[model samples]
Target: MSTSVLQWNLFLLVSSRKEFFYMDIELPASLKLTLSIVNSIPIIISMFGFLGNGKVIHLLGFHIEKNPFTTCTLNLSIADFGVFTSFLHTIGYIDQVDTIVYIYLLVTYFFLFMYNTGQYLLTAISMERCVSVIFPLWHRCHRPPHFSTLVCATIWITSFLLTVICIIIVIFRVTTKPLFYLLLMNAILCLPLMTVSTLVLFIKVCFRSQQRNKGKALTAILLALLFFLFLAFPFTFYVSYCYYFPHLHSLMLIGFGCSSVNSSINPIIYFLVGRRGRKSPSRVSMRAAISRVFKDVGDCTEDKKSRTESKVMI
Candidate 1:
């Protein structure tokens, strides 16, 4: 009887352990499915918009006068797609997920890296606009479309290389301390560049008050900087904490979720704030103005016909 009781207790313990492992696996799969659905919606919407407009061509093919806003939207869409796809492959399919995750991780990281570079590219576009507005002669002479294209290409290439290096580092399972150090270095570098771009924009606004449009431009750039700061800081903090305390791995995972929110927030910011037009003509007012112009033209033609009839009567 004593042996039977001991055997029963061991069996229960083993069953409980298996149940716990299964629960752990299922919970993450559920979460990943939820997250993928949420992330995928915006990506799908953006893709539809990109295709509905002619923006898809500019993104996939080379064009001399590539629309900057469309290009930015494309980059954002691609990044979100990568994030969603990676999450699905890595988190949703856990049993055979490792190899898929590795590949998807590289894909996701490449998109993120490119998105960051695209942010800088946007800053460059904004600065170019400001310079063109303020110094038309100089901008006309120096800012060639081909040069801009080359710069964008270089930015994409460099970003891809950097991301590849990071992926390699991750694959090798580099020490946490080194990863933390690397993240810190990147954050440090990004901060100064973001700050300088912000400061330059501010000075342009303050000194070039003649160009009253600077306010909107300044606000857009500042919003981009804020998005970067918000997205990056939590991830950096989590990484630092993980480096110091290995037991807080769960917190690091949560922090990663917070960081991922940045990918979604960025395009939202651009769509909402960056796309606003000048206040002079509201949509309604613009339509009314067009109607009035057509009405006046009709009236003028009628008047001319009536005068011609009167002259013929005379």
Candidate 2:
């Protein structure tokens, strides 16, 4: 779950080729100590991330105004929290004890589901913002009030079904091929969609638009997307590649470390973006900062303003 389930399956498959099992693979004492130290770093970092995400969830869900973007962010924080919680399982430690392995597998299923749901929700957030910018009139006049909530619910359901199907495939057929393709499909579909949507927002809103304010909201979204693409994507690509070259198993810790950083960085991004122009960072409360990020005119007000400005110019 924290790592790919496919990675575990491939590890089992690799035992057929070489002595890859933890009990079988012999390492020097120094290397084992180094790996153990490196592994602990993520756990410490993830604890901070878990706390930060919890704070974000509390503020966004309870304190901020209810808008589509805030709704998306609240869910995003929950997903990140789940990621850190599930990462607590020591899947890397292969014990002869069956109880530990069973626990790891159980946690893995939920991890995959949450990770996939987060990816889809992020894509939806970016795409929705881009559309509102590109087609302002349509966005104001025709968009449903609860559209974001509906999309998020749909994403959760779809992710659950897909993860269940993957588990079923492994249980019955004992192959990793289905899960591998599923990961490949997610990377192929969601990443490009996010990239394109984010790019459009930058070009239209940041580079060329005539809005009086770019606002902390858009700034927060842009920063978050940038961090995810740079920090988390290494792990995403690594899992896809590791299936073929299981010899690169040594780098798995590094990959997970990158992901943990990505998972934990969003709250910091929001705070910094929201703290802009303030005389002192400590003076700005978290609730005030987050509210500034989610502040935007209502659909009707924005549409009316647009029409009035157009008539005056003409």
Candidate 3:
């Protein structure tokens, strides 16, 4: 039967790969060419990603004043930069998959580590905004000054550890179970938290609040979160699924391209949102525009305290 023939071919294919993690299944010439082209696009996109996120990093890391939201933004930019740089490995290996398969696998997981960290930071940013909006007075008065710094540090360390474990498992030919569960856990934890928190912020700021200045920082957060959900989440979910079911690994190129765009677009989102309401087309500098975004959000939170103190004095 045709089914029996297909089973035999599958068995022979797996047997020859030797390295289970490599999963070197054969591809048609046209399909290979398509994947090669797809993979090359991310390499090109990484240039723009580097420039955009680099400016963000330079601005937030040095020039901008330290605040909780700015702390998260700085870390997210670093993670985005990491993802962009990791794509550089694809430069020489687009058509050939024989010799550097192990290196390829390591770089792939590294990309995941960087991207997962971004997702965690995004969730944190959203939740912080939501809480500040929902409980403005308490958040303003009692929230710890170093909270965002602590959270971002923890996320980077944890993601790095998990990624090391994943690479080790892949190297040693252990079961792929850990990779699947890690991805699954990220999906379970990050996706829902980001969704709910974003929704809360949107409803409260856009519809319920009477305030005229809802803050461009929050607008930037909403745009970044939506981009991740639509553009990046698909690749995350797909790669996780493919790890469990190796036959579906052919779409890796397409997924990376999608995620590359997601990583590349955040800087533009910040610039556009930050530039809102500015009448002068050429007067606003990048630093000025970005400063307004974070400054406006800080003002929103601190304005109540200032007003209260003035009332008491009066």
Which candidate has the top score in lDDT? 3
Give the CA lDDT, 0 to 100, for residue 4 in model 1: 15
Off by over 4 Å in 2: 1-36, 91-98, 208-214, 297-314
Model 3: colliding residue pairs = none
Off by over 4 Å in 3: 1-36, 93-97, 208-210, 243-250, 300-314
Residue pairs with backbone overlap in model 2: none
Best by TM-score: 2
Cα-based lDDT for every prediction: 0.47, 0.71, 0.73
As for TM-score, the candidate ahead, 1 or 2, is 2
Instruction: Quote model 3's TM-score.
Output: 0.82
- 182-249: candidate 2 lDDT, tens digit per residue: 77888899889889887986776577545434456677777787777787666667777776876676
Question: Which candidate, 1 or 3, would have the higher TM-score against the true structure?
Answer: 3
TM-scores of all predicted structures: 0.55, 0.83, 0.82
How many backbone clashes can be found in candidate 3? Answer: 0
How many clashes in each candidate?
A: 0, 0, 0
In model 2, how many backbone clashes occur?
0
lDDT of 2: 0.71
lDDT of 1 by residue, 43-70 (tens): 4533443333233234223532233333
User: Which candidate model has the greater TM-score, 2 or 3?
Assistant: 2
